[model samples]
Target: MTVKPDWLRVKAPQLERIGNVKEILRDLALNTVCEEASCPNIGECFNAGTATFLIMGPACTRACPYCDIDFEKKPKPLDPTEPTRLAEAVHRLNLNHVVITSVNRDDLLDGGASQFMACIDAVNSVSPNTTIEVLIPDLCGNWNALELILQAAPEVLNHNTETVPRLYRRVRPQGNYDRTLELLQRTRQLSPSTYTKSGIMVGLGETDAEIRQVMQDLRTVDCDILTIGQYLQPSQKHLQVNEFVNPEQFADWKAFGEEIGFLQVVSSPLTRSSYHAETSQGINETLSTLKS
Candidate 1:
């Protein structure tokens, strides 16, 4: 394992605020991707009074070697009360924006799409002013299931294209690169008003050219938002980091993404799918203003 660089070091967040957020999650019996996936920005985001709620599980159906979320061939049944509890957390946290993501539940026919919808509706019911973002799975290419998620109409729909095509089989064996692009394309076609977002993790032995090509491919599907971040190895069992991407490279990717017409490009060593996600609504306002 390679030593993490100084740039990758995260500053500790205010413990009081983080504890408050955790208390709410625990009290409500909810899960957050931040803790389940071992996200580095947990403290920062938590201290800022935000969390990316993990809905269906902390246990995933797929055991992707690169991810930290636990895998269970037969995970527990979906808790019908989860949506209501998650909505209560959003209301208590008084969040201006909320991101809801779920583990891959291939055991279910709908791929947990209905759960995503129920969560969306629940949040809207209690916190109508809050903007909703759902970072979803490809649903094993179930277009009809994807349609169910779209019907709920989240303000932003994100699906991470976790790695380059060349590394897909090794990094995301259950996932298809083309399917990711198709999902984004379908999102644009199905709900033109909603923003389509995707993310990529660097330091996975992918070439600079490969990263740029992924960005270009996302643009081809009219993905509106892009996030590029460094991939940190979760455990010794997981895939080791290939390299530490420098800040300058992240800046270059941001510039290239902007040049390719992405409405927003968040690239940094610490950038995650929902890192500072609330800011995205401003882009919608900006685009609307320009159109007006």
Candidate 2:
């Protein structure tokens, strides 16, 4: 196992703002991926009044080796009132941007796409100015379900590719590399106005060449924003850390991504999918001004 590096270490979450956000979440009974997956930047994100809400789950239907979320063959029914509570939390936080994600709900007929639409609508009703980003699962290759979610019109639709294709069977046994790419492609075709984003985690025994090739694959489908981060082992039962990618290598990947035409690239040992999500909107404004 590679020794945990100093660069990866993070400061403890400070209170006041973070405490207030937690209080609102607790009162509404909502979940965020920051707490559920043990994200390294939870402190920074929460203290800044931002969070990636995880709707429809703390449990998952698929058990990927690298993921920390628990799996249940038959998860309980989706809550009818959860969407309003989530929207209320977004309003209370007064965020300009928000991320909403979920577990792989394969047990559901539409892979929980209905809930995504409902959540998007709820957030819009309460906080219309708050841009929404959904870091979604592959929806088990349900294109119609993907279409359903697109109809609600989020500002950014993100679905993480997670790892290189060769590692799929081991790293993400239930996930499909081609299917994931297809989902992104379909998203672009369905809603060109909605910026399509995808992310991948490195340090899973994937070669640098493989990572670059995956970035190219995403570009072929016109994926806009890219994120590359080191994958930390979640527990003894989860996949062991193959390597701790150095910060310099992450910088190289970032440069390469920019060169290949991604609007923004967030690459670092501590980067996660939702890390600095609000920055993308600012980037869009800058690019729009430049174009004009």
Candidate 3:
């Protein structure tokens, strides 16, 4: 494994106002992927008063070795109040755009899609003007669960194809590459008006050809947006960095995505699914107008 490059370093999020955002989470008892996933941009995002709300619990059902979230085969019961609390946080923050994601709940009958719907409903009730984007799991190939979540009609539906196909078994042992693509494809089939987006991380020993092929596959599914970023190893116990892709490469991918018909492309080392996610508002509007 290669040593982590200097470009991957980020300034600590030390802005005094960061505490103000943290207070909302503390008061409402909400969890965010920024903290649970050990995302490198936590300080910057929180300091800016924006975060990806991680619904359900921080524990995941599958033990994807590259992931940072805790794993448990049998996680706790879903909190009925979690939706209300999450909605309260959005209301208190006065946010116009919110990102909601959750742990893999294969243990649940609907794979946690109902909880996603509840959270979306609660947020919509209080913050009706707020546009929502959900980063969802494969639901263990439960297409019905996918339709249930899509029925809520989030502004954007996102599912990350975290790594390339070859790396699935080793990096994301439980994830299926084709299943994820099918989910994105079905999102378009079910909710054509809803903008479909998917992201993949580089530096996981994936080649440039494989990355482009993944992008092509996304376009085949009629995906509207793409986000590509560097994969940062969360801990010493996790997989080591295969290579640190540079800024220029990310820029190239961004241009390539747009050239191939993606409405927008956000590519960079710091670009996570929800990184600068507010920009999604514009993409949604454009897609809406085109459909109308």
Q: Report RMSD (Å) for each prediction in the order shown.
A: 2.2, 2.4, 2.1
lDDT of 1 by residue, 1-292 (tens): 7889999999989999999999999999999999999999999999999999998898899989989999954688989999999999999999878999999999999999999999999998998878888999999999999999999878889999999999999999999999999999999999998899999999999999999999999999999999999999999999999999999999999999999999889999999999999764447564334323
**What lDDT score is found at residue 275 in candidate 2?**
92
Quick one: how many clashes does candidate 3 have? 0
TM-score per candidate, in order? 0.96, 0.95, 0.95
- Segments in model 3 whose C-alpha atoms lie over 4 Å from true places: 1-3, 72-74, 280-292
Ranking by TM-score: 1, 2, 3
Residue pairs with backbone overlap in model 3: none
Clashing residue pairs, candidate 1? none
Better of 1 and 2 by lDDT: 1
Q: Which ten residues in a row have the lowest lDDT in candidate 1?
A: 283-292
The local distance difference test score of model 1 is: 0.93
Q: Which of the predicted structures, 1 or 2, would earn the higher TM-score when compared with the native?
A: 1
Best by lDDT: 1
Model 1 residue 15 CA deviation (Å) reads 1.2
Query: Candidate 3 residues 1-292, lDDT tens each?
Result: 5676788888977767679988889888888998899998888888777889998878889998888998954688999999999999998888768999999888999999999999999998998888888999999999999999989888889999988899999998999999999999999999988888888988889998999999999999999888999988888899988888999999999889889999889999988989988754347566344424
Candidate 2, residues 1-292, lDDT tens digits: the string is 5679998999887978788889989999998999988888889999988899998889998888888877854577999898899999999888778899998888899999999999999998998877788988999889999999999988789999999999999999998999999999999999998888898998889999999999999999999988889999988888999898999999999999999999888899988998988764436564333223
